[model samples]
Target: MTIAEVSEKFGISQDTLRYYERIGLIPRVNRNKSGIRDYTEEDCKWVEFIICMRNAGLPIEVLIEYVELFQQGDATIEARKELLIEQRKLLIARMEDMQKTLERLNYKIAVYEQVVVEKEKELKRSEN
Candidate 1:
C-alpha cells in the first residue's frame, strides 16, 4: 500500500509515518519504481506494533532500542523480554497511581453529591 493508504488505514498522519522511518522507530519502507513508499505487509505490522507500544506509554527511546535489538537477530531475545518486562512493571505502577487518583476524585464527587442532597432536604423542611 502507498503511504497515503497506510496513513488512512492506521489513522496516523503521513508526516508521522515518514518521521517514524527517519527516527528508526520503524524499518525503512520499500519504495516503488516511482520512488514513493509502498508499505508491505511486514511494514504494516511494524506500524501496528509501534502504535500499540506508543499508546501504552512506552518511551520513544525504549522503543527505538527495542527495534534495534530486534534487528540484531535471535541473540537479543532474552534482552527484549527483559526490556518488555521492565516496561510492564512501570506501566503497572502508573496504573496503580491513576487508580488512586480516580478513587480520590470519586470520593470528592460523592461528598459534594451528599451535601447537595442534604441542602435540598433542608430547603424542603424550611418551606414546610
Candidate 2:
C-alpha cells in the first residue's frame, strides 16, 4: 500500500510516517519504480507495532534500540526481550503514579462536592 493509505489506515500523519522511516523506528519501506513508498505486510506490521509501543509510552530511544535488535536477527532475541521487559516495568510505574493522581483528584472533588452541599443547606437554614 501507499504511504497515504497507511497513514489513513493507521490514523497517523504522513510526515510522522516519514519521520519514523527516517529515524529507523520502522524498517525502511520499499519504494515502487516511481520512488513512492509501497508498504508490504511486514512493513505495515512494523508500523503498527511501533505505534502501539509509542502509545503505551515507550520511549523513542527504547523503540529504536528494540528495532535495531530485531534487525540483528535471532542472536538479539534475549536482549530484545529484556528491553521490552524494562520498558513494561517503566510503563507500569507510570500507570501507578497516574492512578494515584486520579484518586487524589477524585477525593478532592468529592470533598468539594460535600462542602457545596453543606453550604447550600446552611443557606437554606438561614433563609428559614
| Model 2 residue 74 CA deviation in Å | 0.6
Lowest-lDDT window of 10 residues in candidate 1?
Answer: 60-69
What is the TM-score of candidate 1?
Answer: 0.92
Model 2 error, position 108 (Å): 1.0
Clashes of 2: 0
lDDT of 2 by residue, 48-114 (tens): 9999999998989999999999999999999999998898899999999999999999999999999
As a whole number from 0 to 100, the lDDT of residue 79 in candidate 1 is 100
TM-scores for every candidate against the unseen true structure: 0.92, 0.93
Candidate 1's C-alpha runs over 4 A off are none
Instruction: Return the clash pairs for model 2, or none.
Output: none
Candidate RMSDs in Å, in order, are 1.3, 1.2
